[model samples]
Target chain A: MKKVSIKDVAKEAGVSLTTVSQVLNDKRDRFTTDTIEKVLAAKQKLGYLPNKNAQQLRGSKTKLIGVLLPNLANPFFSTMMQSMDANKESDVDLFFLTAPEEDIEAGIMHLVERGMDGLIIAQMIKNPERLNNYLTTHRIPYVVLDQSDDHGFTDIVRTHETGGGELAARHLIELGHKQLTIVQPAHLTSNMNLRMEGFKHYCQSHNVATPKVIESTLSKAGGYAAVDDIIASHSTAVFATNDEMAIGIIRGLADKGWQVPQDVSIVGFDDIDIAQYMTPALTTVAQPIETIGEVALQLIMDKLDSTLTHRDQQSIVLPSELIVRATTARANLDNS
Target chain B: MKKVSIKDVAKEAGVSLTTVSQVLNDKRDRFTTDTIEKVLAAKQKLGYLPNKNAQQLRGSKTKLIGVLLPNLANPFFSTMMQSMDANKESDVDLFFLTAPEEDIEAGIMHLVERGMDGLIIAQMIKNPERLNNYLTTHRIPYVVLDQSDDHGFTDIVRTHETGGGELAARHLIELGHKQLTIVQPAHLTSNMNLRMEGFKHYCQSHNVATPKVIESTLSKAGGYAAVDDIIASHSTAVFATNDEMAIGIIRGLADKGWQVPQDVSIVGFDDIDIAQYMTPALTTVAQPIETIGEVALQLIMDKLDSTLTHRDQQSIVLPSELIVRATTARANLDNS
Candidate 1:
């Protein structure tokens, strides 16, 4: 298992070291097709891994973008990452980090220290002004997604979370659900708070009883654990801030011998992949997840390639829609 | 948004540049607590992001580890990654890449070129020999996980795939299911192939009819699309290779007016977080996901610290267990 160098590739290809190096680095227009093929074959046979550090040291673009998300275990985030990966420029490479609230600043700094050309931060930053100051000062191009407010620091790309929440509330209200409950995370980000605001606003405007609120962790377990409280509230319908929690609420209801949309109607936000696969088929607000990912990446690429000026900050907000499924039905008066 | 230099930090802290540098780099024992706090406060106020590349140039350890998994969209992999992130050493940083079949080599080379001290590859390498040669020749400490065969080149950590399959088959059989079906991915990895082999072997040895096989992608949509074929097979029980596909199958069944464990029992592999939250509560083969993640990181750390010898290639195979939830029951003779 000897380390194969450019010299080994050149020797195997019967070419000069320069030819091997040039061909491997995509500087192949000057070389004959036959020579380039031979060099590639030799490199493959030798399992040569070109030292990118050397190229990087010589002032070559790494074309590496760093992406920071809240968590990957959530299908919503994972699917968004997949979309970004699929749509990114073929030559560009992406590295990912899970930057929960506590680690957002550290994650960005880590990526910056590693010399990422640009970054896409998809987590809530507790101190946006400070982070914005750091990125701007260092001249690191970045895009912020899903943050409560951009604070006018960087380009932002996100779905209309408030509108999404309004849609969820409207759909449930149309189904004759007057007494409702909204399950949300205990610690609300600006985005989550906006969603709550929209739902409450819609309910208040409709002359329905203001929906009760139950705070949880924004996970399936969080939703499952809130079932006892939900039962105690005697609400005819519930709105989970996200699909994962909706799935949990469904299971918890079944465990309590209650049928979804029969004894209790439910609405969820974030039409993640599993939402459709839920037995009762989750009725949820559908965020344009793929578009959000694509737009975020495109913004970063634009910044990196100088197609978009850093000073001309842009905020792109995509619309969300309500997708009615079996999870919602007309209120059963007997249950009320 | 002025770029803050070490000189500024020094002036802000009312200390020399050398003192600020030493305090920031953990050389604080020579200074009093008051001076250390001053340096830290100054650094925080200025939002300084230390350039680790300078330290790397001076031959300081980056302590960066690269993790390559097939896809993060799958909860099994995502959860494993979370566990790794939670259990990694305080100073160690993990950067992740999603390497599907075509990108494995490129991803490895990218990480290597980025100067990762050690790597944990959790994907199925199509050509392990060549990659092994490349890694070993470079003296890069690495660990392989979930590969069908190790090829005796590197340390491997995996669950007993064959035994996991056997457990699934035995559970269904014990519940009096005879007409069984196994839904799996069309492109079978060695681990998956082993799971299929074990299930078929158990059925044959028990003198039961060989279970029917349905090939699809290893996703929820794959299982959802196979429902028609499953119904055609007249199987009273089904084993989906993973929980995602199992979820799809359950939904597909429900859509076609069938009931799980009543009309056809269902069992799934990989007891991911959402498995228990499924309406019927999926019966699944549970792998030691957290333990595997922790062990893999520990192995990489051991290699990085020189506590584990390069020549001592360890292959650790953890056991898998079956958790019987409400997804399975005594097979209905009427369905068969």
Candidate 2:
């Protein structure tokens, strides 16, 4: 029941204690491949885990990064988390925390208290200035992702929200649909608001009547509950802010005896995994989720390694593409 | 920039340091409600966060729990995590780690090394015996959730896998579907194998021909890829082990010019949030994810509090139910 120590690994590998420590701490560049392999094998054989706290006390890197996300039940966020987890370096460990709006501050504090070398914040922060100040004061390297507002003091990675919205609107408008409706959550984040703005801008510029807007929660249930309103609006085409809502709307339409792309066409945002698997493969604005994850992680790592300084404040805006699928079609102008 | 200390809170609240410590550590039963409120308000005003490591050094609870899930992309697991996170006590913080099959051991070590008071593991552990020994030796309280195999030494909470499979089989049989198929992953876990066994058992008992089995990865893409094989099997009814695959199967069938419930009836397991939102409102076996998460957290808390000893080894199995939705219907024997 005795705890295995670096000494045991050193003895087992017939190496010095310094060699064992160096290998375990990821300072193996100076060591030959055979020696490094031997140390790792010895450590594995002895089942030795370098305690993060102990390592911190010894002034070595914990090699741990913390990520704060809005929701995991939503496939978009979960898939992003999965991609980051998959792409992170093997020696670096990630701790994930899901924080609804009210919990963002507390969640950030929890990760900070854990002494993470860096952080990735994907949720909306109520006070970006205050958060930047806090993180800077604590000397913690961090990056912001998916938040539409300029973080002012941190590197930001996000998709072109406005372009995404315009793409959805243009597709539906091009289908000869004069009556259009957009579904979104009652409480709008900056990113969601930008999408709405872009949609409105596109419609106004095209000299088409402004689309009717329906407010609902940002979830499947929200879209389901908005079905009655959608029907009453008499819109021939609908643009849902996210694929989850679109899926719910599609089901709701079917339940009410309305057919997709025949009675109504639906365009959704965020081409999450299940979007394509829906009955009439949803036409959506495809955000490069995998690329975003990679960029965000790399940004954080650069900061952690002192390659990207705090003042750099890099902003990378990735493009969103419109994916044409079965759900969208020519409007039934004869019925109109 | 000075760190907030207990003394600062004590001065702000006009209470002694001992009172502040006791209140913050959940030992406030002896204090009046007024005193507890004042201490909490003072702590909030000063933004004082107790250093967990410092408290641990003083022999106080760290109030941290670690959860290991197989995959966050799976709605079933993600929803369970969300439930547990929502239901945990305010003072308790949960750290989440997603570990695929190969990373389970390393994930456990990482959490344990961080000195978490308790652990909830929802993923499959290859060497439960070794894990049990290691945890016991370290005096860490832990519980296994959703793992089908019995651990000789830890508490377990899981759904009735066999009963779930039986429910699926019974529904299809009652619908008069003679050609049945059960789609599962290529590599079966003990729990998945149990589901298949119960499905076959029900078919045998009913004197129906042995149902055909199709192997695919446990994902939407996997199900979509297996569509040709499923069609070749000529199954009048299909039972997918999870909702993700069932969704893909439905989409694939649509692509192949087949109609659900008219040409084939499909039932899925783990009625995830999107199940009811599917075009046909997928008929699925529902696992009470919220209940399971609650029970699992409660068990881990009980152990941490010393109310449930390691020797107790409680095995709580919850039931699964079949929800009949639009995707299932009576077989059209004439088409055959």
**Candidate achieving the largest lDDT:** 1
**DockQ-based class of model 2:** acceptable
TM-score of chain A of 2: 0.85
Q: In candidate 1, residue A264 scores what lDDT? A: 94
Q: Which RMSD does model 2 reach against the true structure?
A: 7.9
Q: How far is B192's C-alpha from truth in model 1 (Å)?
A: 0.8
* Top-scoring candidate (DockQ): 1
Q: State the lDDT of candidate 1 residue by residue for A80-116, as single tens digits.
A: 8888988877567787788668877888887887767
Estimate every model's Cα lDDT from 0 to 1.
Answer: 0.85, 0.84
iRMS values for every prediction: 4.5, 5.0
Locate the minimum summed-lDDT window of 10 residues in model 2 chain A: A304-313
Instruction: List each candidate's DockQ score.
Output: 0.30, 0.27
Q: Name the runs in model 1 displaced over 4 angstroms.
A: A1-51, A307-311, B1-50, B307-311
RMSD of each: 6.5, 7.9
For candidate 2, write residues B1-336 as lDDT tens digits: 234668889999999999999999899899999999999999887767775555554555547788888888889888988899888886677877787788788888778887567899988889988888777655677888775367657789988999999999999999998889988998888777888888899999999889998999999988888899988888899999889999989988889998998999999998998898888889999999989999999988888775433446689989999999989999987655
